[model samples]
Target chain A: MKLIVSVKRVIDYNIKVRVKADNTGVDLANVKMALNPFCEIAVEEAIRLKEAGVASEVVVVSIGPTAVQEQLRTALALGADRAIHVETDELPEPLNVAKLLAKVIEAEQPGLVILGKQSIDSDNNQVGQMLAALAGRPQGTFASEVKVEGGKVLVTREVDGGLRTLSLDLPAIVTTDLRLNEPRYAKLPDIMKAKRKPLDVKTPADLGVELKQHITQLKVETPAQREAGIKVDSVDALIDKLKNEAKVI
Target chain B: MNILLDSIEKVVGSQNVLRGEDVRSRTADWMTKEPCLAGAIVRPANTEQLSEVMALCYEANQAVVTHGGLTGLVRGGMASSDELVISLERMTQIESIDCVSGTMTVQAGAPLQSVQEAADQAEMQFNLDLGARGSCTIGGNIATNAGGIRVIRYGMMRDLVLGVEAVLADGTVVNSMNTMLKNNAGYDLKQLFIGSEGTLGIVTRAVLKLHPQLTATNTALVACEDFNSLTGLLQHARKSLGGELCAFEVMWSSYYSLLTTESNRHTPPISSDAPYYVLIESLGAEQKESHERFEKAIESAFEKGLLIDAVLASSDHQREKLWAIREDVEGLAHLLAPRFAFDISLPILEMDKYVRKLQSAVSQRWKNAKVIVFGHLGDGNLHVSVATGDASDETREAVESLVYEPLKLMGGSVSAEHGIGLKKRKYLNLSRTPAEIALMQTLKIALDPRGLLNRNKVLPDILA
Candidate 1:
């Protein structure tokens, strides 16, 4: 069984993001970028399934401009068998991305598809469900644990209060959460070999999809800096201060 | 001694003086996990309090050892049963940071990691970093002139320190707290205590130089087939990376294999079959351009046959993992127990031949000894450890001879970054000439006439 994992390139989580002086957007001219952390978890899960003999191959796909290939190469180094790049100059809306992924899924016909629950950049948690709807397959969203048993994918989802288990048939989609598995560092030999691995780059038009921007961003501003709070001696004093000074009672 | 302890208690407060079991419970040595044997441990709140306590000790002719974070490999912080320990544990305040001037005024007892974090929070960096950053104190780092991975780019602790505030043995405070980048007002008095290993005086506070924090970091673990290629690769990285090269750590296959394969403590990032592996790093202002330059350097090194195999970390996590393998000193110590660890520096060209000769000498005596070698090659320092299943004093002396005797001819120092504390004091002659030794002795006598501070450390005993 072939496992397909979708990845996205985003600003590295370690960077302290800066807002442009003009308030246009984040100042990301030379910021460090890496595979979105959640996407890395998804790729790690797919690779583990292959290592466990449940999946014969792991293929990673990403959609963006040429810069996204760096993330694709990273996934390949992390033991993905191959990669497909749905190249476009601008990032598409979630619906359009799902459409493009649906076309790739049809062409590859993988038994399982994995994706991060949301992209950290956009924080849009709709792509997996939309792709499942487009591909006519069941999806297990916010998966904390995933297991393949007897031609069925068992996914344990982290919900509002507790974990909920869901069993989906073959050809299912699973969106990874925080606790699926910890990713492994790519070995040196694998990184060198990843350079030689096959990476097929195609346009969104080739996938029968068109990129579109649905939401308009008006302006960006940094959040207000929090002021340091004073320490109160006792609960009664804290209550009195909160009620009288803060007027929160 | 009891009267002296009582006087110290009065100066620093009764609660600050620990006696009996409290003094016995604290650890004195990091390697042996030995409990402190000091009769009493005094915690000074600040430089003034410490000076008053020192005066009391001086009046009574009491010998005292200053304890920071007791993480020295040379047993420099060790205290005897009759001695008193002056611990700077309570004087750990970060006084102030001059962001415009790029300097931080910090108390001595602050951990090195905390100072680094503070600098980082202020958009600057403290370049002295090591495996023991979490536990080692800034005072200890300053005392030993600590050199770690980044010494290739930033000089040792001496270079990072702008000024120091120390309490002399006779209770005189030398407040040479100069915060300027270029100060030629008079003799640099701070240099006396910078690398003296707390023998001359106790460092109570320091003004440290800080650098602008580099936003971009590139790391790679490259394999070399031979030592020549490894040195060539270092030169190539230095030239190609264009002074952005921060670290060039080379690990011998024997050391790498022991930690990764033999002990199974670490996951080997690359095959340990190569004769050598180098962890190269570069820091820059911007990400995209720096990464491009880093990649070009590595690619050219490969094309020039300076490296056999290489892997560039795709993310910060991967970069840390690559560094973990190089910084596995605890793993090496655990696996090579009953081992003689040597931190020596020689000319880069002589390191390969010296290690081979030392290995043969060690194995000839122990028959099945293992010699592990690795260190900051860019700084001409190598940490060599030999395990022969015995840690006896006689065996230790023999092994020390095998390591230190050859360095005299090779023009290498017996102690590299780890100062010549009690462990390497006897071998000081191997690294220093008679004139240098006499001058060191004269300085020690002039500064600490009564030898009341950190006695029997960093200096050998006078001939009877």
Candidate 2:
């Protein structure tokens, strides 16, 4: 089966997020950006599937600014086959991204579509589901385990309490979770080869997808601070505080 | 694929076979915003079932990925659509807690918080801790060799783990769960899988070493004029508190100010205006002496002019409040659009200069970038975050080179607490020798011959 993994270029999670002074959006003027953490997992998973012979080809697709081609190259370095960069300077909302990606899905018609559940920068965990909806395909989210059998996908989801199992037919959209797989590092040679791989860039106009704004930002403020409390002198005092003041017990 | 499913169903039963929407929930990890792409997820209740699943996967040449608690900072647990994932979620029983031996034998899927609670119930202590303790698993901790607050006293996960039970690619179970503290066995095979990030083998269970519960605890926040004073204060605390000193976390002024800002959760215990702050803690068997010694150490440091100001925690509430400033990094998330969190280590002698150089380099590269530094200074580990005004690949690469290049020249590790998950893989050679990396690959090839177990993770691509 041909596997197509969709990745995104987002601000690295380790970096602190800052709101713009004008409250227009996040200040991304000089921050470090990389492939979304979940997308990296998607790339890793596709490579593994191809290596195991379960997948014939693993293609990567990204819908973002022209610079997102770098992220596509990263996926290629980690072992994706070819890449499609839906080039646009403006980042469309998840729905628009899903729309553009849906076109690519329709064109390539891979058996499976894998993407990150949410982008850490935006925390909008809706793209994969929206894409699945737009593509009219079954979807799985927060998968801890996945297996293929008889042209269907079996996924183990981690719910709040315990594990829940589900199965879906082929040609489905699956988003990645943290516990699904450990992504492999791109080897130096792969990095060089990725530069030579086929990276086809398409414009939003070419794809016939309109860029739309879905979410508006008002203001972003720092989280509230914790209050300081007095330290007691003895264990008995600590016990007293826990019992009466803090009331954790 | 049908044969693989039949074998898995035989091992785990049809009830545990998850697919579709269930697959999506299981596919994504804690860090990723993506849904799971796995073909299926299998939960084995015990090592035997897991072994059987591995055998089937090996026969089918199916790619298998192992899932723990999914709390890793790096994207290690994300699975693909075609690969089969083996989650240890069903194998979470704490088999035994030996109070006398101060050891706990547990299944790999046990949450770290659960282990800590079990140790507490048994009147012992499991010293490993991190922000994700509530969700991270013991196996994941062992895989990442996670380090946290108590690493100053107890060391990393590698030290806390005595022995582990793992299954190789071909269903070979290597049970080396040693309970004793001093096991000078051949090769120390457990080390290979401890921080391999589940590339070599799937850890099934483990025997972890524990410590006697700390009866007396004392905490204090001390202000230092500079790194020299901070080092002097650390030496004083160690000498005075002796083996009782459990934590000595240093916070640079930038971090301290950020934590104590008007909008933050905690007010500064000291002035929050100091150039450097050290949050010190001592845990011992005697409460009175522990407090007395802790107070005396700070008093002497003050007398010696090494300390600018000191606030002793006379109560547990105060202690936690002081620690909140150092431990609560989530609050500072709003300072920069893209924050580059780096956990790098250098020799104590060179750390100050190295940090200054890092700051200078970051400033030179991005004049507006904010460099906030802090960490377990006692352990030669520094947690740095460079806030780039704009989030871009160029800025990320520039920041990484600025922070990592100094470590190569200073004989420091690229990663001190965090493992080289895909993010830091290229810089692995900064601290490790070429021969060392080669040995890692040799071991990887030996254990996972097909390179299917977390393939392409820690070791660089050998074919390259």
Candidate 3:
């Protein structure tokens, strides 16, 4: 069995993001970028499956411009057997990304596909479900734990209230959550070896996927600075202040 | 000391004064973990309270040892059974940050890590960093004139500190807290207390200079087959990275292999086959351009045969892993216990020959001795640890001779950044001339007349 993991490059969590003066979007000119934290979890899950002998290979895939290859190579260093780069300049929507992933899935025919629940850059948690719909396969979203045995993958998912267990048939899609697994540091020798790993790049047109934009971002602004709260001597003062100042009563 | 404890308790409050087991419960230093042998531990709330306590001690002629984080390796904070300990643990307040002047005003007891974090929160860098930052205090850093990984770029703690407020032996508070860069009006009085090891005066507060926070940091672990290439690479990096180059740490093969062996926790990032591994770090203003420049510089170095192999950290996580291998001082301590650790510095050109000569001398004395060397090579400092199976006083003395004797001829220092504390006080003459020692004595006698402050620590005792 083979496993396919999808990753995305996003702004590093350490960076203090700055919004453009025009309020159109966040500035990304010279900011540090890394594999999305959630995508790292997805890559860790796929690599763990391969290490456990449940899967024979782990192939990582990413879609973006040339910079995305850096993240793909990072995934390869973290124990992915190979990498595939779906090269495109424009940022693609969830449906288009799902279409591109479905094309790669058709060609590779992996037994399992793991993806982050959402990319941190967009926070639109629909790619896994859309890919499942396009590929016609079962999906376990927001998976905390995954166990594969006898041609079936048991996924324990984190739901609104508690964990929900689902048994997906062979050749299923599992979207990783925060609690899936912690990623390991790439070893020195492994990193050297990753440079030699096969990374095949193909254009989005080669995958029969056309980029489309459906949503228009109007403006992006930083949240307003919260005003300091005042102290009240008693509950009566609090009630009176809330009613008069806040005007909520 | 007992006569002064009453007045000390009155000034700092009784609960702030600890005695017997309350005092011994604390460790003497960061490394030894020995029971503190002070008569009483006094925790003053602020600089004024500490001044009052020091006044009482001075009147009684009581010997006192100033404690700041207790992380010094040279037994600088060690106190005897009859002496009192004036611990700065409670005087840790960050007064304010003047962004316009680019300075942070902090109490002496503020931990180095807190100061660094505070500066970072203000979008500024403190510039002084070390392995013991979490426990070491600003006062101690100032007292020792601490130098760490970035000294090559940012200068030492003496350069980082703009001014200091200290209390003298007779409890005279000298508040020379000048926050300007160019204050040459008269004698820079703060220099007297900066690296005196708490022997002249106790630093109560300091105004530290801060630099703009770095946006991009590029780190790489490169291998050099020979010492010449290592020095060559350092010069090349200095020429290429210029002011942006912050740290250039080198680990000898013995140090690297021992810490990164298969059984060790760190997997060797680069094969431990090379004679030297240099951890090169550069910090810059722009991320994209700095990264491109770093890559180009490294590629050119490789092409010029200055480095045999290299691994550039692709992400922040990878960068930390590479640093972990370099900062594995604990791993070295555990592996080479009963070791005599020496922090010495010389001309960079003499380091290779010095280490080789010291290694042969150590092995000749003890056949099974393991001599491990690694440090901030860019700053001309190397931390050499030698273990010959026994930690006896005779063995320590023998090893110390093997390490310090050669440094005398090379015009090197016995104590590089650690200072001439109790451990290296005997060998102070090796690093300083007779006139320098006499002048140091004159200053010590002038400042601390009764020798009540950190007695017999940094300066040697005057013979009767």
For every candidate, give the share of true A-B contacts it also has.
0.39, 0.00, 0.20
Please give, for residues B1-464, the per-residue lDDT of candidate 2 as tens digits: 66788779988998777777887875365533578788888999999998988888888888877888886666677678778878889889999998888899999999999999899878699999777788889999998899998888999999999999999999999999988888786889899889889999999999999998775777777788988888888888888778888888999998888778755677665676789988888887765466567666766777788888776553344466777777776676655446878889999989888878878878887788889988998999999989978767888888888889878887899899877777788889888999998998888888988878976677788974
Relative to the true structure, candidate 1 reaches a TM of 0.89
DockQ of each two-chain model: 0.40, 0.01, 0.25
Sorted on TM-score, best first, the list reads 1, 3, 2
The candidates, ranked best first by lDDT, are 1, 3, 2
Classified by CAPRI criteria, candidate 1 counts as: acceptable
Positional deviation of B375 in candidate 1, in angstroms? 0.8
B311 in model 1: Cα distance from truth in Å? 2.0
- Candidate 3: RMSD to truth: 5.1
Q: How many residue pairs clash in each candidate?
A: 0, 83, 0
Give the per-residue lDDT digits (tens) of candidate 1, residues B412-438. 999999998899999999999989988
* Chain B structural similarity (TM-score) per candidate: 0.99, 0.95, 0.99
Poorly placed runs, candidate 3 (over 4 Å): A1-5, A14-29, A37-60, A64-69, A72-96, A106-126, A138-249
The residue ranges of model 1 lying beyond 4 angstroms of the native Cα positions read A1-3, A14-29, A44-59, A76-96, A107-111, A120-125, A140-170, A176-249
Q: What does DockQ come to for candidate 1?
A: 0.40
lDDT of 2 by residue, A146-183 (tens): 78888999988899999988898999998889889866
The C-alpha lDDT values of all candidates are 0.91, 0.83, 0.90
lDDT string for model 3 (A10-87, tens) is 988767788999999999987899898888999988888888888899999999898898889889988999999999
